[model samples]
Each structure stands twice: as C-alpha cells, then as structure tokens.
Target: MQQTAERPSTAASSSLEIKANPITGQERVLTEGACALLQALCQEFAAEVDTLLARRKQRQQSIDAGALPDFLPDTQSIRDSDWKIRGIPKDLLDRRVEITGPVDRKMIINALNAGVKVFMADFEDSLAPSWEKLIQGQVNLQDAVRGEIEYTAPETGKHYQLCDDPAVLVARVRGLHLPEEHLLFNGKPIPGCLFDFSMYFFHNYRQLLAKGSGPYFYIPKLESHLEARWWAKVFAFVEERLCLQPGTIKCTCLIETLPAVFEMDEILYELRSNIVALNCGRWDYIFSYIKTLKNHADRVLPDRQQVGMDKPFLSAYSRLLIKTCHKRGALAMGGMAAFIPAKDPEVNAKVLERVRADKELEARNGHDGTWIAHPGLAQIALEIFDDYIGKERPNQLHITRDVDAPILAAELLAPCDGSRTEEGMRLNIRIALQYIEAWIGGNGCVPIYGLMEDAATAEISRTSIWQWIRHGKSLSNGKLVTKELFCNMLTEELAAVKKEVGEQRFTHGRFIQAASLLEEITTADELVDFLTLPGYRLLTA
Candidate 1:
C-alpha cells in the first residue's frame, strides 16, 4: 500500500533555482512608480513577514511537541442507543449515500428515510451570505436534530412540530475559510457577535455529543497533511476540554485545494479512523486550478460554460482519490455537481438535463455518490447513483490501478533540474498541455519513458497536475519555466477575454479552455472543429 504520510525531506541542498516574483509580473509594468515605492517600503518594513513566519513556526513546533491529552476520551467509549458509527453496515455499504439541497428540509427528510447515511445541511458556499439567514440556519439544524421541526406556521412568530424521528447524519456550521466576525457580503461585513464563535462551534459539538449524537464535521480547505494534522490536534484539544471521546468526532474533509489532492494519503493517515468520507470539491477546485496556472498568460480565464468535466487532470485526480479511499475501505464520495438552474422553464429544463448527464458521467466513472445543490435535482443524483449501484458493478475506466503514470511523466517532462528552481509557470503549462494531448488520444494514464513507475507515482502525478492547474502557474520555473515569459503571455491574452469574464476577475477557466483547444489542434481541420467549441472564444483572456 502507498504510504499514508509524506516521507521526510532528504538532506538539504545548496544552490536553488531563482525566478522573478509573481507580484512583479503585471504590477510593475502597470504601476512602475508606485511599485518601486512599495518595494522600497517593503524593504524598509519587512519585519512583519519575519514576525508572522516566526509565530507560525513556533505554533507548529508546539503542536509537534505537545502530547496527546491524558483526558482524551476514546471515541469507541461513547454509547448511543439510537445510532452507531462503529462499522458501516454491509447493506448500507452496498447502497449509496446521498446529500440533498438545504432549501427543502422535506427532501432531506425524505432522503434520510430512504436510507441515505449522510445529509449535509450546507451553509457555506451553497447558502447565500447573510447574518439572519445564517442564524436561522443554526436554529433549523438544532430543531432538525431534535426532531421537533415544524413545516407549518404556528400563527405567531414560530412553527413547532414534534416527532420521534432521527436524522441520518447531520453536518452543521459553515464558512470554513472566513470566521463569523469576518462574514461579509458585497464588501460589507455582517455584524453579530456570539461572544466567541469558535467556542460556540466547539460547545455545539459537545452538546450534540451529550445528546447521543455523533460529533460530525465537514472540514473544508484541507490544503496539506499538516493542515489535516492541525485539525486533528484541534479536535483533540476540544474533545479533551469538553470531556468528549477521541474517535467520536468524525469528519469528512472536502478536497478543495491543489496541495490537498497531492497530500490526500497523508491527510487521511493523520485523520485516521476519524475520517468518515472524502468529497471532491469542484468550484473551489476550479478556482484553485486557475491560481495554480496563473503563471501562463496564454492560459487566460475561460468562460464558465467552457470548462468541461472531461479535462485530463480532473479525471485522473478523481480516480486517484477513489482508488486510494476504496483500497483502505473508506467511502470515496463524488464531489458536488452544482445544478444551478435558470428562472425560465425552457432554460431550467436544459440545465436539469445537463445535470442528469453529468451525474450519469460521475456514476459511470466510479463515484459512489454525488452532491446536488438544488432540491429539484435531488431526485436526479439519487436516481443516477441508484441505477449504477443496481447494475452490481462499479464503473471501470480506461485508467487502471497503475498509479505512477502521471507522476513519472511529470518528473520526466518537468524534472527537478535541482537548483531550487522557480520556473513552475512554463513547465506546468508544457506538462499540462502534454498531459491533455495524451488524454485526448485515449492515453488516459501518464507514460514515463525509461523510468521506474508504479501506482504511487501515477497518483502523485495526477495530484501534482491538478495542483499546478489550480493556480494557473507552477511554483518553480527557472529550471522549469520563467515568470517573465508567462507574464508576457498572460498580458497579451488578458486584453481579449477580460470582457467575457467581466470585472472582479480572478479565475483562470479561460486559460484551461485555451489549452484544451490548442491540445485539439493536431490537424488543421481538427483545429477548426475545436474552435467551434464554446471554449475557444472564452479562452482568449
């Protein structure tokens, strides 16, 4: 089996590859005078960076040196007469675990009744931003957990309906990146103090546990195994202080970052038995891809509609995740297929059809279950997963268990020339473009010429590709690809696609689209055909 954690870094090296800074790419040209002044100021007042770095280093060292609390409760010690998480029932394993939209509590209840093992009452990205909406969401969750929720208005200012029903599994709280105090909309922060929101979240977990409920969570922005380790340590601290059990606080991390994909095994290893599931997060994943490839100017942001699901890195990453999780007997969940529909009935129908088609693809590709944001599309996710499960065989793809394909390819194509090089921008594009070419030619797996390769190698390549694509640039480039060349290319392309994406532009969907288009240009006739696709025009910026 592949190691679940990263091996320690080998002994240090001397010379390192140097590349131009990313911040200087466009900013220097656009605001040369101001940029120079700012650089001067930074040189004079750079102590803050050192201070922040020192603090972070200290925090990590403290965590590493800290011992597991003696009061840490055993997760297995908790006994619930009504529910259990010891072992996934065989019947449940054979069936699908579905997540429904938060708008319709009725649909969620219905899905739970239908034997779904988890129901995430999403509050983060799915729910629109607002203080009132958030507080109301908490109340709704509390009521739902107690089975005292009411669908009918009680004439006054409340609604109450009593029942003895139990929630299949409840995920509460939201805003993973932003804390409650930082909650803002349209550049305005929402004001409402909960004394200490962190304490509130922790205390809520304690209360839920005391009520014989499992302490479950959906951890987002899991960037690295270290981040995962931090969450584990934090959970340990809370559990100890609250007099709760260790393994009782189960969590399913949302794979939402480039580094997280590469560090999946390590993150899982760190979380261990506390990890209940893993979901492929799409929107943020796409955003991260843009950030990853931000180095290449030619790979401008693509139109949202142009970003296809058939991209090479996404498929490989998704497959790698499923393989890793399944091999360890853990649930590998397909990430959310955001089924946003238009107000027009005709447009809505088209949207629903697209969602159904995508769900079908996910089911056929090896996803055990998927997410749906709209209640109207709840039946679509359920029905599609059910159909696949009933067939009695998992989706088998062109990509096999050989996991070293992409990693070895990456190493060969973008080898570590060993100078601590900072030329990731160019190398990432070249490698990604090449990967796409191979993928389009029915060569789904990366082929490493004249090098040792294995499943672990392939998984790392997929993970690395996804990470590079996430940011629209690689971390190194001198020995890989230079930042100046990338910035020049981006400057040229940005003039064309800026209008399509509009103002407040930060994503790089346009870039992915361009690369996808260029990859199809093996022949002149094929180039025309590729241009006809929506992505060609969208990729200009």
Candidate 2:
C-alpha cells in the first residue's frame, strides 16, 4: 500500500532555509611545488580536453545563432572504431545510491531521511518536458543539489514550493542525440547539449562546493567508454581551474546502450577516480537491444509488463553485475521498480511482492541496495533490504561443473541474434524449452543437480522461453503454437546455439553453465549441496 506521511512538520520547514554561495577562483592556494606540477600537467594534457570543449562551445554558439555545424561526427563508437580512451581507471558497480520518487519533495525527503549515502536528482527521464515545467524542474533540482531552500519554483498553473533539505542531490542531465528518452532540439541532435548541461551543472556545483557541499552527479545514457573518459577529463579541468582536489566530483554511469554494455568493464575501469555505483538499466537497454540487432524484427520491444525481471538474460546480467560489483568491493543495486500501479491494486501488490523478493535475492546474492520510484515504496523496499542484509544468509549454491555458463549465456541470448546458422537457432530452442519445463512444473522450488532454485530464479528460466517464443513468433508465419511444435522448434534451435557459441573465440562458459544449473534447481537445501560441490563459491556460510 502507498504510505503517505502527515503534512510537512516545522522541522521540514526549517530545513529549507539553507543556501549556497557562488564563489569563483579559489585555485590560488596550491603550494609552489604543487602549482608548478599542476601547471605542467595542464600544459601536457589540457589541449585534448580544451579542444573538445572549444568545439562543443563553437557548436553551441552556432546553434544559438540559428546555424548548424557543417559536419556532425558519428556519435556511436563500434568495436572497429579507432577511439583512444583515457581517464581515471575505476569501476562504479555499487558504490553509490539512487533516489527516484515521483515528486521532487518526496525524492529529497527519502534521500535525507532514509540514510542513503547518495541521491541522484533526476530531471531528464523522470520529469515531463513542458517549457515552463522544465524551467521549474531545473530550479527545483538546482536548489535541491545546492541544499538551498530559498529558491522559488517558476510559477506554474499549480502552486508548488521548494523544500529546504540537506540531501545530496546529484543532478541528471539530458544526453546528446537521445531522441527516444528525451526531446531533440531543432533538426540536429542539440549541439553542445552535453557540454551546455555540464556547464549549467558546473555552475551549480561551483556554488554549492564553495558552501562546502559535496560533489555528485548521475550521468545517464553513457554509450561509450570514451564518454566516461571524456567526462573524467572535463571534470579534471573544472576541478583544476577551481583549485579543487584532482578527483573532487563523483559520478555514476547508466549503462543503457548495447555498446555501453559491451564495454561495461572498460567504462568501469575508466571512471575509477570518482565512479560510485551503477543501475541495471531496464527500459533503455531493452530499447537499445532491439535497435542494435535489427534482424529479429519479431522480438520488438516486448510489453514492459510482459518482460519480467525473471527473464534469463536480464536475470543472469543482474546476478552477474551484483557479483561483479561486490567482488570489486562496491555496492550492487537492483534496478528501478517503477511506480506502484495506480489503477490495479492486484498488479501493484504483485509488483511489491516481486520487488521484495528481488531485494531478498539481491541481498542474499550480494547487493548493497535497490531503487523504487515512489515515496510509498521506499520504506518497504528499505525494510526488505534490512531483513535480508547482515542477517542469517542461506548457504550459496554452486552450479554443476557440466553446466557451461558461457554456453548458457549464448543460448539465452541466441533468440536475439536471428542468424543464418542452424546451431544458433537450435541453442535458442533448447534454452526456451528448458524455461517452459521449469516454469510450468513449478521447478523453481526443486533441486536440480543438487542446487536449490526459487521463484525469482525460475522467472529467469521462463523469460528465456519468452525471448525465444518472441523470436519464433516473428520468424514463422502467424503459426499457432502446440507443445510438440514448440519442442521440435527448440530441438532445431539448440543446435544453432551450440554452433554459434563454439565459434565465439572468447568464452565465459562457466557462468553460462551455472545459469543452467540454477534453471533446474528448486530448493534451498539443493542449492547448499550444489555450492558445496567441487569448484563453486558458497554464498552462505
């Protein structure tokens, strides 16, 4: 149920009066040796950063003057691109936090009151873009991030006031050429969009930093590792010019693009200096997957409702990410659970249950946190985390050695390829059939090869089936599905999957095998045995 608090108290009112000052040129404090070194560093690498900024500024000036630059560079960098990346080498797996309430006030309250370490003040995807609305949003975000309460919300048809709170509000700006997620200005994908946004953010950052505010940012839709490196370079310039610490600013990247996912490891390495955490970006990533792999026309954006968190690829990705983040000593947070369904209480209840289950699994599996989109959902989400984290953890189960994770990942992801080879198609079928068998039989709670599986884990198995069905539905002529027809289809598809997986010179087969083992297990006891078996990490003591 949605929990609404009583009206704002005097304390809430009192928190709003804090304001930050705008200060300039504090870099003169460096000692002679430090100053000389800093100057030398600037002279050596400043040109690269400066050139990028100058070009960006030039493009912005042209845009304001109603002109387009003669040439626009390709925004995407593929495997073949000769792009050189440089920056702080760090991974932001789960070091930070996310604040995603529907209302700004609610978001601020959750961050300030919940004891969460970081809070991203989202204005791009979360805020609707009406001209007046955007200005009001910008002011609200600026005030929130600045920890100031005196700013007025630009007057809208409805009267809303800004709140004074000492929350760490890291602003999320719109990205360049991102048309689907946000608006596109003029015909050209808003020239200097990122630069201008950064400048505005820097404007507020300088103001707040001078008042002893912390440095924070939530960078979204970062497609390339170069983007991470570029942002680092830009931050370095700002900090250097401001006479701040070398890595004063903190950031979290949203790996929403397929390319971003491919280079996630690299991006994590690049943003090391100030990188904090990462999200399992749901919507944008789904959208990107469809756009990238054009052949599978049938598997177009699945209804978001139909695409549950249990789907194999996403489930594995989520689990893998959590493990990856924790291994690196960073936090691994679960992805966003959208607003509690307003119209259907049943659906809302189910959503809450799934969210709770996911939180339990994440904490059990090793995650620092998760995100929700409403104030009403926040307390429950936190409670769920509390219950599982730092408590009696069940022993972690290990997958059977025979189950090849790389092969499993390949099989789960096979449906997306829609390739010409028979082996690719065969592997996709094998994975889907395995999913249907597990879901229909309630195999989630059963043991498979001595490993325990649960409902949440079961869903991953089911989703793989769904992904495959989506592919077959698209490939075949409106054919009615029968059990035999489905089984035959899978038999053929599994072969293709095997052939393709075999050819992928690079392999992470063990992870795929582990997924296969989880696909079959249904009970916690079984999981204990599975983990205790040779060659696996036991999550539970």
Go through the candidates in order and give each one's C-alpha lDDT: 0.44, 0.44
lDDT of 1 by residue, 115-206 (tens): 44456665544333233344455555555665655665437654434334433454533422332322222223221111112322432554
Model 1 — which ten-residue stretch has the worst lDDT?
11-20
Model 2 C-alpha lDDT per residue in residues 288-399, reported as the tens digit of each score: 4443442344444333334545666566656655544433333455676554534467776776787677667655655566665544566666676666553343112121
Which lDDT value does model 1 have at 301?
37
Worst 10 residues of 2 by lDDT: 532-541
Question: Cα RMSD to native, each candidate?
Answer: 18.6, 19.9
Give the runs in model 1 whose Cα sits over 4 Å from its true position.
1-97, 100-117, 128-131, 151-167, 172-176, 182-213, 298-301, 340-349, 391-541
Give candidate 2 misplaced runs (Cα > 4 Å). 1-97, 101-118, 128-131, 150-166, 179-196, 206-213, 297-303, 341-348, 391-412, 416-541
Task: Give the C-alpha miss distance for residue 317 in model 1, angstroms.
Answer: 1.7
